[model samples]
Structure formats: structure tokens, C-alpha cells
Target chain A: MNHVSDHDADHDSVYDGLLGGDDSQWAFGTDFEDPLAGVDTTLPEGVDGAALAAYCLMLGDDALVLSHRLSEWCSNAPDLEEDIALANVALDLLGQARLLLARAAAADPSVVPVLPEGSPVPREDALAFFRDQDAFRNVRLVEGDRGDFAVTTVRLLVASTWRLALMQRLVTSRDAVLAAIAAKAVKELAYHRDHAARWVVTLGRGTEESRRRTEAALATVWPLRWELDRTHEVERTLAADGVAVDPADVAAEVDVLLDQVLAAAGLEVPDVKRTGGLGGRTGRDGVHTEALGKVLAEMQSVARAHPAGRW
Target chain B: MSAVATVRTGYADPRAVAARVTDPEMPMLTLADLGVLRDVEVEGPGRVVVTITPTYSGCPAMATMRDDLVHALTDAGWSDVEVRVRLHPAWSTDWISDEGRQALREHGISPPGAAPHRDGPVPLNLMPTRRALTCPRCASPAVEVVSEFGPTACKASYRCTACLEPFEHVKEI
Candidate 1:
């Protein structure tokens, strides 16, 4: 009945790496390099620092909020494999978020709040956890509640497709940091979009129940799609500086990609009308949906409780 | 201290030491084999700096890789070690060394095929990526993907029809 082998008896514990005495190094800590290290972070000519930082916030917040939504599906996915897949996608977006947030803080350190002396929190962590809901700049498409699995997949398909298009153009940004981040992001978002597209097709072509649910999910998510294409003032300003992509420019490409995916799945594009904000003040203008408040509360609670906390 | 004395006290080749540090997730492959250890330099007497690139933007193993590089160089008698990450000219699976591919194969994992070449936007392909690979265990060409994602960000799960064995494939980026 003995399961222990000779090798096992040689060690007093099995979790050598986890239980090691090295308490200084933790995941997502200061061990990794600065995402912008060695890169020329100088501002481009005639580009306002505030505008550039706001643009980064817009993209970074979108990733951070959607990543949080995806992470909520950690153990709740339909199956183990899918659970892992969603987690992987979430982790990728989180990584992108960290870099983007760091870039934002670097571009405009004033946007980051002043914390207690010797606080271990990096500016990126501060931005992610300390911002008020009214300060967040994420589009509503990403901040909505995680609907059913099918709905989530549809959202992912649309979000990643649009992001990939934006990132593709962002690779040529006048800002080196944005260009580097975009170069890395384009590859990751493509994979994410592909994963979502495949699932959409599978579910759409599955049993009648699955197809019906997939279509319903698309209908629920389609109206929010227009907000992704609306160009905000910060984006418009940065675009003029050659440091940002006008989402409006990429809207057509996103539509074509989405249409292709829907056509493959034998599903029609939902004829839902585009939703709007109150007097043109959208998420980019610090006006977010109620869902964003709930997401930010949960995401920022732990960090706010102990601004100096490190694990 | 004399120049000769300083040379005697200095550590062995930092690159050699760094190249031997295995990936924390894929222990079978060293950082060099994984194509992440981009450069290793002896900055001064005991200070060594290592450079690496992540296979994916959100790779969880990156921090671990950095820590391992520092630990390995320290253990090899270097007093000061630093790791830097580069994102430009983003990492590609094509950089995986031949020996790295062999190691993955021996570990029952399929090595990645050539990376996709892009002149413009990355085209969307709903169909499964067609990879020319064989089962690492049985060398069977009849293999199908079980899941597009594996336990790690850079891998995918596959099943060999001939041997009926599930395996992981290091997906091309």
C-alpha cells in the first residue's frame, strides 16, 4: 500500500519550490524586468503627455476590465479544458494590462496617486487598484457582466477582433512603448480571437439548443459594439500625433472579420442598433456603466485596504 | 587589486551559466533552448546582466525565468546578477534551437512548426491551424487537437490517434 518511492523519502517535503524559505520573491512582484526597460520612452514631438496617458488608459482599462471579467470564469467554465483556456486568455490580457498601465504612469506620473512613503506598490499597481470608477476609461463593451458562456464568447470574439485590428496599426505608433506593446499584443489578440471564433462556430453549429443560445448571446452583445468604434477626444488627439489609432478607421475591418466569423457559423449579424452614452460622455470620458463600478470595487478592494500590501 | 587577481576571482562564463538554467515550467528546456535567453554579459568584476524575451505577452513564466536566471548566476559564483526583458522584435517560436526541439520531442511534446510570415495584418483563420507534426511518442502523423490551449500559454493539447496518447504541442506564435 506504500505509495512513497525512494526519491520521495529523500525529501522531507514535496512542494520544494512553493515551500522554500525564499519569501522575497513572489509572482507578479518586482522580480521581472520593467516592461519598458532599455526602451526610449521619450515623448514624441508635439504630443501632449496628458493626451498620451489618457489614450493608454483607455486601452489599458479595456484590457484590465475585460481581463477581470474573464478571470471570473476561472472555476465556473463549462469544462476543465475551457476553464484553463479562459484563464490563459485572462492571464495574457492581465500581462498586457500591466505593461500598458505602466506605460501610462510613465507617460504621466501625475495620474498616479501619492501613497505612503516606501510603499511597495508600483505605479501600475496603483493605477489599477486606486482609480475611482469615474476615473476609469474602459469602453462599456468590456465592463459588462459576464453573461452566459456563449455570451462571453461572443464578447471575446468582438473585443479581440477589434483589439487586434487596432494593435495591428498601433505597431507603427510614434511612441516606442506603444509600438512595442502593440507588436506583442497583436500576436496574443489574434490567438484569442481565433479561440473565440472557433468556439462561436462550434456552438453555433452545435445542437439546436446551443445554436439558439449562441444567437441570443450575440443579440445581447451586438449593441455595445458601436461604442468600440467611436473615437474619443483623447484618441483623436493622439491619432493626430501619430501615437494612436482612430478606432473609427479600424471599424470597417472589425466588421468584416466579425461578419466572416458569423458567416462561417451560419449565423446572421445581429441587427441591433448601436448604443450611446449620455450626451457623448462615454467610458473614455470617465463615464462608465454601472457594471464597471461593481468590477472595480472587487478588483480594487484588496489593494485599497492595504495600499502597501505585498504577497 | 591586480588585473590578474581580479580575473582569477571573477566567475566563469556568465552566458554558459545562464544557458544552463532550465525553464521553470518546461524543465526539459533551458532558457537558451527556449529562445528566451537573448544575451548574457559580464558587466564588471562580479556583475552579470542577462536579457530575455517572453514567448507571449502574458506569459506567467517570465517572472520565474527572471528569478531562475539570477539564482543560477549567483550559484555559479557571480555576486551581482540582473535580468532584463525586451519586447521589441517580439519572440518567435522559430528561435527555438534544434536541440530545444529535440528535448521537447523526447519529453512527449510536439515541437512547433515554422512561424507564420506576415506582410500585413494577421489573417483570421477559423479552421484549426494546420501544423505538420507527428506524435512525439508514436511518431504518428494522425494527430488531432484536443484543445487549443494547454496548461501553459504557449502550448496546445493534442491526441495521437494511432497511439491514443494525449500530448502537448508548443504552439507557434
Candidate 2:
């Protein structure tokens, strides 16, 4: 059991009262009934709700799947300190995923993946733990195994860097909710990017083995990284309509930022090839690499097995 | 009970009521101290509108905060209440009031030392420990980070080497 303080003091502001303990359900890892309660849920004029829902899933799934992957390192990270750091990062992504999934549901209820009836899980949890592999919209990069510590760091650096760039642009979105979410989350994403960047730097320059592992990690992930930048047809259309930021638009910024981090870390940007093929389809099209199925199978197993159980 | 009748029967100003609604999670702080009591509007004689911003996108206390505001105002005899959440100009720890800082200290939690120079420059992060956080309990600079992620999203867990006590510090976001 963790020690939660009982101290409570009266502040000058009106929002003051004393809870006996850290009674916040979220602190104890419980979801609230509705995260979007009193906010106006109206879409901006001319923005398609269905399309907006689709757009939300694109971002949400990325965070959701990656969050799960990172959670795998909870007890398995190389060191105790790093175990907490990685889990914290995973929780941050999980938090974003929860919001994005909830937004998607609020935008269009049709987007909710079918969960077993009478399930007590929240809408966001349902989408996260119930959906099949092909239904997930995250990029192929985050779906793969947590290779080595070096691999995780480099992959995190690339993904978090790319996300920061997108989030920076997203703060100006036409959709007020989306813009608000981005604005609040950008700061978090900045920390995430910096955290990964520092690790990549340490690993790249520490010793011969670390340097080799970092380089190897970069090489392994760099080829598959191209898929993250390719925009889906829906995303492109939404970007044109001013509802979403196209994935392709952020590529330059991501590239420049990664290059700087890589150079500073004494690492090289590996010569990775694109896996894109006919129809320009990528993860955004409900298409993903072969690894995603195995990821989903493990992620969904517990929930699927015990559909009525509550965490 | 004597104060209740005088205050609740006809307290026209909704801010007074809304401000008193403590954050359910961090009980010592109020929405005003937290800098989230953005605006309170009196639509007509009895109608009121309140605006708030979340400290984080997935802040669970948001729903509780909204409900608390509505209930507190309604109990104060103000009908037709609307609580709206504003996301633009997102909430930051920097927005936390001085009174909020003092309150956090007294409640055994450390207020944010400084806002992370978020968009300042790329190297700000690479620089060693932007600012050292003092332990709220012992006011010692000898604290170490126990965990980057605390019990909740907006907090980081820290332990004081001086007092050997663990506490939560609001992380700059």
C-alpha cells in the first residue's frame, strides 16, 4: 500500500475541501464515468462527425497500442528507475488514448467497436481492449515487440518526436475539442520526446556495446518508420477540409528533429526502405504489418477471456 | 447552521460558491487556487454559466469538478446553472495561484518549481536538472525523484533525503 497524506489546508480560492486520502479514482487507476461531461460536444461548422471520428481513431489507436506495448516494460525494464520512467510514459500515452477514443465515441457513436453486452468497461476501454488487430489504426512501428532497451529508446524517440511535431500543429485545429486536446497534450508530448532523446543520446555514446545497440536499434526501426509519415485517404481529405493535420505535412519537421537528435547522440540515420506498396495504403487504412495480430492477441486476451471482470 | 441560511438563501455571486468546491483529488486546493475558475456568468436573475479548463486532457477530476460546481451553486439557491469546459489556452501548473502554492506546501505536496521551457529551445531539456525541487515537508534541496509518474497524471513522486518522507510534486506541463 502506498502512503497517501491526510494533510488538508484551506486555500484562498473557493475550490477547497479536504479529502481524507488520495481518493481520486484515477490516482488509484479507475476511470471516471464520463471524461467529457459539461463540455459542449458540437463539431465545428462543415466538419463531418463521421470523418472526425475516423480522424480521432487514427491518433487514439497510435497512443493506445503503443501504450500497451510500453506497459510490457513495467517490470521488465533493465533497471528499476527506468521501469517507472517507461511505465509513466506508457500511462501518458494511455491517458491520451483514453481521451482520443472517448472523443471518437462522442463524435460518432458508430465508431465504437462492438464489445460484449453488459460489459462494465468504459467506452474507451472497450475500443482499446475489444477491437481486433485490423480495426486498430496505429502505425506499424509501435506495434512491434519491445526489441531491446536501445531499440525501445530509439523507437520511442522517433515516435514521440513525430507526435510532438503533429501535436504542435494540431494546437491550431478548427475543431475546438481536438485543438483543446492538442494544446493540453503538447506539453506532455514535449517531455516524452525529450525523455527519449536523452536516452538515445546516452546509449549512443556511453560504450561500444551501447553504441552498437543504439545503431542496431536505429537500423531495425528506421526502415519501418516511413509508414508513419504516409497519410491515409481519409486523413488527406480531412486535412484538406481543415479538420485534421495530414501525416505527410509533419514529416519534414519530424525528419529535421530526429536528425538533430541523432547527430547530437553520435548516431547515424540508418538507410531504411519504405514498405509502401500498391494503392499507397499503410496502417491508416486499417492495414498493418504482420506483427500487429500477435500484439493484439496478447493485448486483448485477458479482457476477452474475462469480459465481466473489472480491474 | 446559522451561517448556512445567511449564505445559501440568496448568495447571488456564483463564484463564491464555485470557488469553494475543492478539487476532489487534491482536496486542499480550490478551482480558484488552481486557476481553473476561468469565468462565471450571470445570464439573468438566477441563471449562471461557469467555465473551466483541464490540467490534462484525460483529467478525471474534470467531470467531478463540473459536477461539484453545479451542485454547490444549486445548493446555494442559484438555479439554471451551466458548467462549460474551455480547452483553449490550456491549463498549466504556472497558472496555479500563489495561494495555491502555499496551500500545496501546507498539504504536504510541492507546487511546481517552474514551467518547463516547453517551446523555448531544443537544448533546454538536455541541460541538467532545469531547477532543483525542494521537498515540501522538510524544505530540503536533497530530495530525489522516486518516480516520474506519480499516482496521477499531473504529479511526480519525490522523496526527501533529509526527512525520509515521500510526497507528490505537481509536474510542470
Q: lDDT per model, in order?
A: 0.87, 0.79
Taking the tens digit of each residue's C-alpha lDDT, what string does model 2 give over A199-231? 888888799999999999988888778877877
* Runs with alpha carbons beyond 4 Å of true place in candidate 2: A1-32, A114-122, A276-280, A302-311, B1-18, B21-25, B37-52, B59-85, B114-124, B132-151, B156-168
In Å, residue A174's CA in model 1 sits off its true spot by 1.2
User: Per-residue CA lDDT of candidate 1, range A63-134, in tens?
Assistant: 999999999999999998999999989988998998898889988999998888877777888899998998
Minimal lDDT window, size 10, model 2 chain A: A1-10
Candidate 1, TM-score vs. the true structure? Answer: 0.92
Instruction: Estimate candidate 1's alpha-carbon lDDT, on a 0 to 1 scale.
Output: 0.87
Q: Mind listing the fnat for each candidate?
A: 0.60, 0.39
DockQ of each: 0.52, 0.28
DockQ of 2: 0.28
